[model samples]
Target: MSRRVRLALLTPALLGLGGLFAWAIAGLPEFGDYRGPYGYVLNQIVVPLRHSTNVVMGTTFDVRGLDTMGEEFILYAAVVGVTLLLRDESGAGRVERRTRRARSDTVRLLGVLMIGVGLLVGLWLVAFGYITPGGGFPGGVVLAGAIVVLYLVGSHRDYGPFRNEHALDPFEGLGAGGYVITGLAALALGLQFLTNLFGYGKAGTLLSAGSIGILNAASGIAVTVAMLLLFAEFLETYVVPLEPEDVGS
Candidate 1:
């Protein structure tokens, strides 16, 4: 329809959403209110139950894992939608073109160095997510950022492991699927879905939080692969003109 009509409709919708948000916010306890019931439960119930020192991680990947699963599926759906909508179906192969501006050797060397460091740090965060402040989400972002650095330095193609788009595609699915499988396995064992089914080890150690560690690693993999896939798609985008015969058909 007309732009004016669209704007009129959108204005009320925005206002309605804002009103609902404000109403919800108004119901929240005052800032710095430790006397709130939610805080007490978080400190006493959730943290001890998960055996996790990182309260945020415990809440996200364990206490509210079902909610997190919904969020993950939304992200997965968005990536799939983007891929389908932007699919290259013109049948013309990718056109090669040289960059107008070249990066300096120093930048390239730095990218190589950072890639190793990023990978190490990302894995460390995922592995230690149970005990530490950082988790899979941030670690995954770091890993993706490292790949982006490689792209900036024009070394994406030279990286053999991440070079193949098809190969990387499965990782997104695998990571997400692994998470669901873990939950389902718990269900099969008569435990609640996404429950901390495994034994909680020494509270402060790496292997302490049982399934939280697995979930964190899974989340890291999923986020890293999804981000990389999106980057590859946007980078290699090209337009193909339709042939006259095909257009007519």
Candidate 2:
């Protein structure tokens, strides 16, 4: 069909869906109402069941773990898609040339400092997620930002402990796969998928909230690796002429 005809047919369907979505949202409980059914359930059940004071953490990594797993995979797939789409296929060899402009020593030093601070903070957030506020997603973003800072400081090949880009590929895979494995273990034991199969330590403690800490750590690792790889792909990108003479034989 022609473009105009396709648009005409799609417009009404799109509008109908949007209207339904708006209607559904309008029917939801009032904003900031702690007394709402969902909030009440989390307050009453999730904390006791998960044996963690952090109800949000319990909800995210335990009660609704399957949903979170799907979301993580969505992000993983999106990054992979972007990387594949932006890949350079030219067979011409790479050439590096020094430019006249250079970053100031102060700027480079600042970047180095930020890398240290970011990594520490990121790990802290991930480790304490079950007991405290933040979790894997935010912690992973912080760690990725640290790697980016290292890249900015002209450390193109390595970032502190992570000396090679190839090693990060597996880290991302492990993070995404670890979550599924944890869930499957629960299923194998006759419990629901993603259930907290391990012991729930004392409430408000680091060891509390069985499986949540592991999930958080896994997610953090995966996210950090994926983001770093994405950054490396963009940073190392180059273009070459399509002429036969310029192309490799």
Candidate 3:
């Protein structure tokens, strides 16, 4: 059969399959209760995190830390795949680089100011994850994006002192490694895997919530930097010309 015919035939079958699956799932309980044996333990042990700013870390690191480790490996595999697929061709011919028109000094100054403010806000969110409505993922991503914006609008030559590739990669690796090691250490200390053997401090403080905050920070850094690096690689590949000549003469 022709490819068009195959797609046409498959489309309805796929739609029907999806409809049936959705129908089946629609019959499930809306939400599981916390009165069951497992829920009883989990609620006593874990529900506190639902109110946490670092909810991902609270659930993943303190409650399901081992699973988080596996998830990190999955992310590692994905990054590796991207790196392999998007390897830079150093030997590619030089492209012309048109000098980007300089912006007004006021515009440049405002961009720098925003970058600083954004970075500060992002760090505040990350640092206060244990006590507020913000968390590591949001904070780190905002910080990374703020820095990238600074790169785009404020400066071309230095890109606001960020290494972009070197520092972020190591930081992400360390974050992933720290999460895994923390879990393993907990296990070795005779606790269940990923158990929060450490004390959970008072609920509304910076130092409370045990390891969840740290895990949130780590995962946030990893995710943010990975995204930034991916964007940077894309810019280097399709947008930013390597050599000055590549731009129209």
Candidate 4:
């Protein structure tokens, strides 16, 4: 069978299955009562746990932390694969100095300022993720955006002094390890996996949500470092190729 034929058949089959499921659900109770134990749990426990309108976000970082760990690992693996595939070849010659573009000093200064502010805000978001609306993943992305802004404005030579890439692996490793340890601590206490071992604290305090806060912090650190490392590595491998012209040929 041709690929087109297979896809045509598959599409109809999926549509048929979807229709069947819809019909089956349509036949179920229309006016249900929330009185049972399961219903009570749903009302009291499950609903309260989801603090965000973003369903996937709430589930990944809050309700299903273990699963989120696996998801993070998947992302990490993808980054590693990209790094490997895009690495500079051994045969590639060293980069030589070249007449570089004249970067705008004003823009560079603004980028540095933005980087400083973004870093502080991102850190706050990560640290207070459990208490507030923001989270580690979002915070990490914010930091990455700051890095991009810095790169866009600064001279390529400026990145060399930063060594942001070198710091990433160790920091990420620490964050992952911290998350795992936090989980294990909960388990050791005879609580469920990734349980909120620490007090939820005051409803509005920075210390609210206990272990969840710690987990968010770990995740934030990991994601930030990983993204920065990946971006820097990508630039080195693909955009900044190891050609003599790249340096000074």
Candidate 5:
């Protein structure tokens, strides 16, 4: 289309989106102070009905599970597209470039500490997702952050051991596939898709949210893998030399 015509069509759409976004933001409660009826109701009922202390997780992984599945696949589809379009172009197996490594002891020490903290926090988020504020999504990103720390601190040679598709691909597959299998299993049992099938253990415990917690952990894995894979794809020329097997795959 002509530039004028494109602008004419885009202008109204942009205005409409901006207006809606403003409206939504304006309606949000101030931080640390929420009194919405939905929140109140969820606070009361989530633990009793879903046996999950985190109402957000109960809503996401159980009550609105099918929707969450759709969201997870959205990431899956996006990652697949990135892999297909960019993986071939990376050519990490065919070429190697001079790499830069951190030389400062102070920087390395700080990065190592951050990596440790990120790992601990990420695992904690997934472990207590149903009982606390965080869930799979945030936890996955934190884990990815740890990987990023290792990358930032290590020499290209130092990162060699951890920088391959084989090291990262399995988590992506299991995470994406696990979510679907759980839902399908529910169908096999004639229960609602993504139903909370596993027994709800005592609330406020690690095992409390049943399928909800499982889904959260799976999501964390998928997200962590997805993000790391993206990093690998983009940093192929910067990362360690890929193995001969990687070139064929």
Candidate 6:
């Protein structure tokens, strides 16, 4: 389509999106407003009822999980859209991509050190998300970053394994679908969708919050996959691989 036609279609869509956002934002309580009983109820009940200290996680994954599931679908859909847009359309050869090697041993060493540290922290975040301050989304980002840093430090050979579209895309789709599946699992037991169906486990532990923990994990995986794909695209599009002789230069 011509640019003019594209813009004509896009303009109304942007306006409609803006209007919807405005309508949603308009309903939120103003600053300092504690006008609803829900917040009070969650604070009072989440710990005792859900066996989780982080009331936020309980609210996000159980009390109002459907909203979070919708958000996950939005992100999953975006990744799918990007993958489609970036795919070779004409049955063409692979796009030539370049990897940049770090110019100094110190930088490379630091990157290597950080990889281990980051991996540990990311795993911790995902594992304890339901019990603590972190959750799947943030933890997933950290995990993706740790992996992407392999390429950032010029380990193209190592990064190549992660670059497989066949694996990453499906995993992300599964991660996205995982949340819905977890929600639907409740149906098998005659409970409502997204209910905290299993035992709440011990509070303040890795096993707490029943399906809240599971949902957090699902969101984490989805987020990690989405971020990895996006970072791969950015690298492929913009970074050119340096010559072997340029490795330490």
**Model 6 C-alpha lDDT per residue in residues 77-140, reported as the tens digit of each score:** 8877877777666745454554556779998899999898998899888888878888888899
RMSD of each: 6.4, 5.8, 4.5, 5.5, 5.8, 5.3
The 10-residue segment with the lowest total lDDT in model 1? 94-103
After superposition, candidate 1 runs with Cα above 4 Å error: 1-30, 96-103, 159-163, 238-249
Which sections of candidate 5 miss by over 4 Å?
1-38, 89-93, 237-249
Q: Ten-residue segment with the worst summed lDDT in candidate 5?
A: 240-249
Model 3: ten consecutive residues of lowest lDDT: 93-102
State the number of backbone clashes in model 4: 5
In order of appearance, the predictions have TM-scores of 0.80, 0.77, 0.73, 0.70, 0.79, 0.80
All candidates in order of lDDT, best leading: 5, 6, 2, 1, 4, 3
lDDT digits (tens) for residues 1-249 of candidate 2: 999999999999999999999999898877875455887878799778888677887888988888889988988997788778876678345443222212598988887899899999998888887778888988898989987777567533344345345777788889999999999999999988888878998888888888988888888888888787777666556432354542332
Q: What is the C-alpha lDDT profile of model 3 across 86-200, one tens digit per residue?
A: 7766846334233352358887778778889998998888788656667766777788888877666743454523535776678778768777776777789887666665567
* Candidate 1 lDDT, 1-249, residue by residue in tens: 999999999999999999999999899888886575776788687556777888788888888999878777877887788788767799456764233222577877887898789888888787777788788888888888887776566633354356467899789878899889989999999989987878878777886788888888888899888888777666667443554544423
In angstroms, the error of model 5 at 212 is: 1.0
Worst ten-residue run, lDDT, model 4?
A: 93-102
Candidate 4, 15-56: lDDT as tens digits: 999999999989776667434575354435532554333333
**Model 5: how far residue 89 lies from native, Å:** 5.4
Candidate 2, lDDT over the whole model: 0.78
Runs in model 4 deviating more than 4 A are 1-59, 89-102, 161-165, 239-249
The RMSD (Cα, Å) of candidate 4 is: 5.5
**If candidate 3 were superposed on the true structure by all CA atoms, what would the RMSD be?**
4.5
